[model samples]
Target chain A: MQSTITGKAYVLGDNIDTDQIIPAQYLTFNPAVPEEYQMFGKFALSSVPASQAGLPKGHVPFHTKDEFVSDYRIIVGGKNFGCGSSREHAPIALDAAGIEAVVAEFYARIFFRNAVNGGYLVPFESVNRLCDRICTGDDVKIDVENNLLHNLTTGEQWQLKPLGEVAPIIDAGGVFPYAKKVGMLKV
Target chain B: MPAMTMTEKILGRHAGRDSVQPGDNIWVDADILMTHDVCGPGTIGVFHQHFGKNAKVWDREKVVIIPDHYIFTADAMANRNVDTLRKFVAEQNIKYFYDVGTPRYKGVCHIALPEEGHTRPGEVLFGTDSHTCTAGAFGEFATGIGNTDAGFVMGTGKLWVKVPPTMRFVFHGNLPPYLMAKDLILAVIGDIGCDGATYKAMEFDGDGVYALNIEERMTLCNMVIEAGGKNGVIAPDQVTLDYVNARNASGKKYDVVTTDQGATFCYERVYDVTKLEPVIAKPHSPDNRAYVSEVRGTKLDRAYIGSCTGGKMTDFRAAAGILKGRSVKIDTFVVPATSEIAAGLKSEKLNGQSLEDVFLSAGAKIGQPSCAACLGGPSDTFGRLNGPISCISTTNRNFPGRMGHKEAKVFLASPLTVAASALTGVIADPRDCLQ
Candidate 1:
């Protein structure tokens, strides 16, 4: 929905499942309630082992202690991101934590659908494995229109896979709006 | 029209088309939309937000709310979430609300759906849990979806689906005595990595598959999610029909459909069940496969046999056979998948002793029939791993922090293997005990 999203990248390795994204223990916080929904921000990525919390040099927390919003706005991940559960809380937690877009090699289907259907955040697939290339705390900018990711910190750039068939849905801001726009739902 | 796979045929019929192919995205009517305590309140919120605060559900009978996850916990929010389901069911007049602390309560939705006759052949079923694919054992199109997609289906009995190309897995020989459906599926996931079947349909077939009981068939389909499958299916046979007919209380008729001759599969794999050894998924990932013999004697602090994948009667029977008259060396937790199965533990017997008696006599702890520690609920949850302990479990996942503690290690194996390991306080091969 935005022209470009710019922020520091919090990188992670492959198979960062929903359990690691938002542990099942924190799942009792209902996203329907405003306060409980914000709690997702505080605990986003809380279950990821400290050794794998941040890539390359680990032990980086997504959010500071007791803070609802994260300092980082972008996430770089390897294959099968959000693989474990079908809980939409995975994407909602990342968005609540101030992540604007996630650049991963590929994603598990249900997580991709949840992110796009709920309009939670942009899930962009990079042309190559970017987690190995990008370091945590690297300033990055995602140009949505061009499907390009620029590492402002390293002065490097990479092409991202186009949104393909789901672009219209994401463009219209998720399924409900896309349906109305495509005449599947009455306007 | 060209030949169509079972998945295409099912989606085609629902979409009102004579034929469909892989990559075709069309809206199909949903026969059942199941939600649980974990995702139910969130789905209700989305439904009310988009469809108006007072909007009625598309059809009350089509929506099923099962409160299985996070039940029996002292956590306030977990209890409140069930209350949320109760209120929504009352307001929407939903017909199939399995509330906790009630007679109608069931422990897990995937197992409960078929037991209560909600799963049928040639119908489309959706649930909030990934293991909903377990119902595909009945020749149905069942897959897991998120709250938003579930909410959309709640407001309308229809949702968009992309027809997936089927990958046929044929097993050749009969299952050996040391093997279970868990071993067969683990072999599949091992061959193809965790994301191997992403966005594809997995169909199990052959005489080997047909020989399995209904519960064992459910086990085969339950872990397809681990392979990133959109859905898993099997053509309805006499075994499937017998179970559904006995339980179809509503008297709803279902069509028995099969793959057309010459139907093309995106991929195919054949296994000789007799040749395959018992396997275990090592710590940290489901695809980290190792032969039980290769990892034999690996140290473990506990053993668990419970979940939709491993807590059924068939699983318990297999475990009880190994655990009979043997005292466990480590703490072993045995939780059934549903109350009906739980009751079977009391009524069913091995060597003239009840299954519960066998487990208790083996020094294994029996917990209430819920997803006790498969996903590791509240801190006080029964059998939860609170410290960095190593466990051999029959549950599907062993991802870091999957059970409870972030550093806890989990090795996934079949019930027989887990029982053997429980007796030795290490990962032990079931073949030793079976012989």
Candidate 2:
């Protein structure tokens, strides 16, 4: 895992569920297949309502038409981010779409587990709500080592809650590798 | 030693520990790991990826595969997903593979699990679907997991879990005729916002809870995930024992555990069921709740009764009672959660006519037993809200685009409410149509 992640941030409102992150319609594309996995990026967040797609300003697409990857590398979200469904595809979709980190006030349990266990993205809980402060398409830097989110576009910074116990797992890249590292699984 | 709640007890026993508490991450063995068509292929891919292409599962009998979601569709990929499950089950020689197009085929994984006796008391069950918490009704620690965790469990028969502190929700008094478990859970969710129980266990207790039948108890546990609950549990008693004993095909022994006396709870709530009225979760969110009377006469384009949450024998019977003599004023869809429930719709009668007859006479379109249009699978999925419209449904969720079109609105209600609203072409109170 990189200590610093710098990218354009995409802002979204609260309760951005799995359905909106990657609609059920696109779930048929198997993530295990490299081609189908890449297809997830094309339709990621396609079901988020147009008005709620991008915060502050609306109707902003997470990715350009037919593209598999997004220009944004980080996501800024409100409370209850990833609140619905146990679909691991939600995190896989975000990862496939080029998102490296998601900073939210809090997250639904299953989504948080999937994001970390799957090693798809770094799910950071901000000390305070950052969705209102971060604009979509703003340049942001996440200093994971220092637990700080620097909004380069706005020249403001905020503290992120420490990753705590799960940091080692994330650093090892998902549960499987972590298990092997901790001697839970025989290498 | 500190007293442990039912969830803590189950997790501790599975972890081979005498004591476990909230926030303590421990490795626990899984009694059953369920995977359905939607996530099965992905899980299999992961299992094979890390464990080796030819490596065998830790225990073939412990893995149960059910192909339910996106079934009965012509979509090539959807069909192929089930094929993947079939091939893996054959190669692994798993004991509990309910394949599509076979007599053993079940409709929805959550409902089918209890029916097949896989959901036993004092067992830990992990499934790839969020609603797997439904099995907690049988005094167990059951929760949803992602494919990666499930794959790990598949390979090792164990996975790490953080014990969740239990929140006790004791329901007092009998539920009024107009009220169902759906209404009770909706009330709880409304009181505490969606994320209120984000990582906690919700333990349902008191007279009002046990009074409900097994299916209704399952309904109560089913939506705990909606509030971000890790699991929902009710202490197993005669009602649970009777159901489990009758259905335990393997005759597997399971310990019936309960919250110890004076157990600590992080939070507690009490609800008088008799005081509760018919409630509905309005569009976009499950916690956005309203009394049916508050939304009376709200126009609806469709009425659907189905899914693990609503499509059970009890749900269909309640819906049938309201639809027996009346015809629907709007598009109405009735889907049983499993094939057994579908057969019940035919053999089970309402006033001498079968439940299926009641639904058909009421102008409801009956789809094959599956999760048809609950999560809005394919464009061709039956009962899917393809157009922007308002619907009253017995489904668990009302998230945006949950049913079909991104702009479509879904109001989550009980089967009785959905049937009543179907007759009126609007969101009408079930009490108005109940007799």
Candidate 3:
């Protein structure tokens, strides 16, 4: 599902792992449902006690189809985004969240490839501007193809490079479809 | 002219047109190709899509498929990937399909390959897993490739490789007890920055490499990637072939070779470890190595001794020997890299009993053959911890709190060291309990 409208941004904090991407407990029950906000709430607000913090109150304990609701497409994370496990589902879940691209400073080799092959775009940028300036809910308009990430709320722009050497493949709809079009594989 | 290395020579031989030099993009044929469950599923789809018909893999015999991350802790999506690979392997008639627990299958990826006699000297080996460089211990130029690249290799039997300049690391002097190839490599990683060898090939030189057993060499080459090297190779000698012959009874008439007498190197670092203590890599970064004694009293919630890096047969013996009469601290998990390693230990009737028993007595859960807990590539959690937690692991990497929580810490060490630490429940030099 392509984004409803272009010119959007998604945001995330640092140290995003495959486990928090889709907690292991939900793996058995649901095969293909997005849960973007389901686990992040716990991880982001972990240290901030529920009674004394500025985080939203808890809802259902388990992942639901609603957490996939989108308002963001660009993610600004710290070093080693998508670490832990070679689970392609981590990117698949993000694609299900309608993420046009990720704007992490760096990524694990496997996760970077999985995202491109899954047809989800991830344009990495130097986190210099967005590192401390951008908040969790800040709106970022990242034109990954143009090497730029612009925060709409704060009017800050970050220059970045789209997926290295593999973005064209994602535009063709994952590796299989890309290879099929290139006559590398039989359709 | 930039001097040539063994890897370039081998890749040149495979390239078959002209000599390939460092920094030159050379297309060479792969002698052996492997993909685990994580990368296998994607390659399967690409193989069919790229071939324009039923997927006709370049070579069925040389290719192997193993489900590394999806055994006991099955992720539905990963299992789907496994199913995709299984069905494709059958359709393509791919011969070496190693389901977990199968006979002749055991330990981490590199451990299983050599045990099966798949890796050989002078070969251009490739795997879909990063630590595939472990095969270089057999004196081959082996490296890891991504899924898409593997897909291309699976369909076409060839991939582009940049022939890298060779960096010779000369080790001299006798290795102290409890100081192993793992410690040696960690120290090297410290000396040379993690990216010091990026896109370059590493060859262990001097008397030290020859003195160390082949299993120990695997440990050295296995984590070469963590140092950003594409491959790690050691010239094959009699000892190398001896380890090969010992594995599978495949007296395949090995042609052992060495680097030309005065092969040029891009860089050479030396270490005498004659008096080096047990080494441990601190948390968040594998390159941050320190003496084990320096990191004493670092408590741990887990201890893993499996994975391609430290899952060799001798590694088990080293750990089991050090752990003979001692019991493991509670909450340690011991997973053999492959089932054959378990079988080998079991058949040896270690300590006049089962290898599993020794590990169990040492407070380890005999985990099934798979890369587990090491990377959380499978097992999801590092378990609820008391305060800040630490883990002494024999597997690769101690990436920022890699085990579980960010507050948690991981220490990278050898199988012997990890087992001893698991017994003590804190970071202690294995030599402490040795004599």
Candidate 4:
């Protein structure tokens, strides 16, 4: 099974964390806040709008209440996604963001498992030049079946693979669904 | 008659086939299973769904439950997990219950198991947490399981696992006075990279293993997953057997498991701890090993000194001794591993110095038994843009934003190192602060 999403290509530095994905203070509040308002609540993302976009102001963080929330199917980063605590919230926050896949140079074990278990297809992929080419909301086409993520805007494709023994689960729409069927059976 | 490595011997017993070889895939029935609140509730939920009702447990006594993760209850969900396990414990009639607000609060499952005498050497144990392998420090066969496998164990007290290849880490030299097991493991992580031991059984042997206390050994095994090990263990020798004698003073039935020499280690990694200084994993990555001296000047917003990894009576005593004469800088939290440790810290005297009194006098906010900042399940938020921060902690992992914010740096250090950093309010080598 494969899918694709076209949107702006956003670039973040290494060590992007759950706290940055969704700050703890904002997580305590109702997740119903509009999406833009919820982003980087503890710290704002520079000139990103807070009022019009309704993005979180003053570190409020990853507001889920978003209408035009771009379906982020691909993420490219330096190293270590979900490397910190086994929060499970990191994947949850990404799932809520409509992220279908994350591609990183590397990953922390717990995060990798949590991502697969949550039905988020996070592949370990790195490209030399893709970092500078993609921008926020650039409409990328991720060829999941072939393990290729195409930056639609830049005509660039990257490589990645689902972790060992975890690929099938993500294809099945998360652990809950996978557990309901395949995982129940003894291999 | 030939000798086998400790891992090979253990695997040979459970090999269940002709000549159980290293990396041989085999399924061994688990002897014990433990879970904490953070992952416990998830396991229970999944277990209830599959069983639709409580299934027959292979051994009720062998299964244990501890609500150590979300001790203070960050939110309703955390509280709900505690209640979920509590109800099941009562319904299943499981007697080994370590509750909150007790000296037996059981900080982390691994720390609690050995201290409470729940696990014996040589038996394969499964925990619903990555650090569960800490039990291996006592020479017990232990490994961490996901929620599904954990749920399977909760219902049946058994689960499946491939017999992992043996990776022996032989430390032969005398460690420096300041350096300990954590440093050795960190240095190993530095060499092997984080994923060095994936799908392998790490057996720590040699005189170095003999020198470390169970607490120190637990520290070594605690971060095994940081290296992607299927599990990590040590041979049960006198140090291990004696520990069981003291801990299981109840005279409960005991089972012993050990590996023999000639047992091939698929890979052997050795370390010399003689010149080891307190190592810290820079924030956002447990494998980000750096000498404390290299990152010493890193300023910290919050200094935390507790977790299953760091929160022990011994660790607290060490921290307190380091801070005996000095007061903690503003914004430092010294959380005990568990309530019992907290209570014990009150009377624990490190080198003739009363730590509980010393720390209390220094106004260190003593936290209850729970996985405080290490797992980031709760507050004590540290170094941030409001102010650049670096936290030196006794807990495991320093991944970005682990302490408070992503940018907020955290350094994984020994308890003594964390204590010194707490006093200085910056990452500091304990050599200067310790007497």
DockQ of each: 0.80, 0.86, 0.14, 0.14
lDDT string, candidate 4, A1-187, tens digits: 3665444344444445444454443333322223422342323222222221211122222233453243344555545544433444455555555565666666655566666665545555554534445554556776656666776676766665644556666677655566557544332
Candidate 3: where are CA atoms >4 Å away? A1-66, A77-96, A103-119, A122-187, B21-23, B49-53, B73-86, B100-107, B162-168, B191-200, B245-268, B347-365, B377-389, B400-408
- Point to the candidate with the largest DockQ: 2
Model 2 misplacement above 4 A: none
TM-score (second chain) of model 1: 0.99
- Candidate 2 on B78-121: residue-level lDDT in tens? 99999999999989999999888899998999999989989999
- Regions of candidate 1 where Cα sits further than 4 Å from its true position: none
Q: What is the Cα root-mean-square deviation between model 2 and the actual structure? A: 0.8
- lDDT value for candidate 3? 0.67
TM-scores of all candidate predictions against the true structure: 0.99, 0.99, 0.79, 0.80
Residue B161, candidate 4: C-alpha displacement in angstroms: 3.5
Residue-wise C-alpha lDDT for candidate 4, range B1-435, written one tens digit per residue? 355555555555654533565545444666678877766666666566666664645567877888776667547655666777788788778777787765446666667788788767767777867778788887777777656566666665544444667788888777676776767888887777666776677888888877888778888888787777767887777777888888772467655666654566778867666756778787556778889889887777667777777787667767776788778885767777765576687776766656777887787776666666665544532222233466677777665444544556667778877777877877888899777
**Residue B45 alpha-carbon offset, candidate 3, angstroms:** 3.0
Candidate 3 TM-score versus the reference: 0.79
Candidate 2 chain A weakest lDDT stretch, 10 residues: A58-67
Cα lDDT tens digits, model 1, B333-354, are 9999999999999999897999
Error of 1 at B395 (Å): 0.6
